[model samples]
Target: MGVLGQPINFGVSMLDDKRQEEERLQVLKGYEILDTPPDGAFDRITALAARFFQVPIATVSLVDEDRIWFKSRFGLSATEVERAPGLCASAIFSDKAYVVKNAIDDPRSLANPLVVGALGLRFYAAVPLVTHDGHRLGTMNVIDFEPRDFNAENEAALVEFAGLVIDQMEVRLAAHKAIGSLTTLIKTVPELGIDEVATVCAWTKKILIDGVWYSFDEFLSQKLGLTITHSIHPDAAKGF
Candidate 1:
């Protein structure tokens, strides 16, 4: 997580490993996220931050192991960047806000391509998006072409906006997870409905048993005791 160790001109996986690609994909999937379209809430936050700080570009970035991907970007639609030594990378490593008043004067960021390259970014400030579970997700930040100080007011506003961005991410993931669970159940039994209490009970028991098992679905289909036709009521069979 330290910025010093990360690469300078990265293409993809910084660490070379035979299994790292699979591991990387797993890491991306663990969040149950990847290749998703941009969300309005995230984009709005970036755009508003750009206007508020008067920066030409603003972004909500997620730092993967080797690259930086933009969840939402303003004044730009870049997909990824090398996880090179940059102000944002340093901020993520330190788990604190990075404020580079003047990129040319700041030795730490002076050599960063974003500052020296065609983008010509000068003033940079970013607040780290540390998750509630303590994961260093990435940063919410804005960049401007001018060298200027962000007063206390501006800095505080940036941090507050960063928090909102994080909140939106958390909410989005929660909703996605809820929808996935519901979908799984519906696939298991197509007639799933609130009034169908008996089916719900059966599904619940089967899912519970599946949790302790490696091949839960196969076991459930064989032993869940769900009949294709419910003509013989469970209660009637037991004389309950």
Candidate 2:
């Protein structure tokens, strides 16, 4: 039996870890948030987490291949660190919040460089940023220099904050899609003649092409042989 009184199942744990990592990477890529510029929305959440938990460090961390990058960080200088020997990497493996009261005392974390090295992180608590389809993208975590107990209440608050982060991600994705749709509409405007106007419904925003009325996107695809794609404008967010 392990410290938690459950049998330590190494084989099952390794298999599940592999499967979860594969699915997680796919879902993480879909968000299109990796290496993106910092946003106020994510920054506010991390700042609030640090204040609420009274911790010196907090972060909105996204676990990418080989390294975990901070989308937003409070009380930390380095933006990223290697996946191994990192608490946040372990946090992403579970659906619920993961907490370690003291890294120096925990067998799993005692050897971690962050625990014994310069950073000397002693306390850690994180809630996995899970998607609707049940993939853990990353974590929202708080760290402390001294060990501290993380109760159920603390976990709940962190989970709620993680939800807010996901909400912002979803909104940004929707906005990007809308911008792409609008750009495609403008691009397919079939070079109107001096006095010619394409038949379009003001209410529905559908266009009449040939003898049938079709949705703007569908009309463009069918009439102009163009595919609707999301493209970021140069003046907008630097790169999509």
Candidate 3:
């Protein structure tokens, strides 16, 4: 079935809806994850996905304007591939999982270079990585050189794994925002002539001020002479 620009084939739908595409791209960019270095958190999940599905390749892919970049991968050396003819491109159109039992037999993928060219991809299954607000960023996918079928159980597992991937993305985004806020706090606040800046742990959210270890709030209160209060909601706390 064709939606607006092209026919949907190979269990893949074209992500060509102009307005929606723009919105999706905006949300994807908000994560600030594109073109980032691999992390053990994401890499371990991809590796486990490959092992769980018994597939040779698995990846956490982020769909960009012109390419599908692998945030994490197993058994794949390349970091990214062109968007056209890419299975993950189609996977991003919806929040549901997309599966191709045999790429060679699927009209949408028969001509795909990844299927017939050097990589020789065959079986494929991808669960969309959807944000909490319902934007689909990309996919958590498994691949094999030989054609194979994926049962409903397998699809469910893939979806769960995809959720884990999304969770990681959320954590990374949160950490980034926190750092940005910290930077702003440092710059905007008046200089207290505290000549030496203390060491801070980004991951642990611990700060060292005046040669003493303190929680983020303690550090802020001690250094900036500011009062810190937290809201029950995490997002609400962003204001402080």
My TM-score estimates for the predictions, one after another, are 0.67, 0.70, 0.80
In model 3, the runs with Cα more than 4 Å from the true position are 1-14, 191-202, 208-215, 221-240
Worst 10 residues of 3 by lDDT: 1-10
Writing each residue's lDDT as its tens digit, candidate 1 over 157-236 gives 98788888767766566545544564465467644332323221221323323234212344335544443332533422
Taken over the whole model, the C-alpha lDDT of each candidate is 0.64, 0.72, 0.76
Give the count of colliding residue pairs in each prediction: 0, 0, 0
1-240 in candidate 3: lDDT tens per residue? 111223312222446688888898898999998988878899999999999999998988887877777899898776776566567657776467789999999986888766767667789899888887777788888989899989989999999999899888888887677766776676565574333354667557576655676676776787767899865445423423
> In model 3, what is the error at residue 180, expressed in angstroms?
1.5
- What's model 1's lDDT at 71? 83
Model 2, range 1-240, lDDT digits (tens) per residue?
A: 322232211111222567667877877887889898878889999999999999988888887766677899898776665555456656777677889999899987887666776667789888888765566677888988899999989999999999888878776765556545745655556562212445555436566656677775675577657888876444234312
Candidate 2 weakest ten by summed lDDT: 6-15
| lDDT score for residue 6 of model 3 | 31
Which scores better on TM-score, 1 or 3? 3
Ranking by TM-score: 3, 2, 1
Off by over 4 Å in 2: 1-20, 190-240
RMSD for each of the candidates: 13.2, 11.8, 6.6
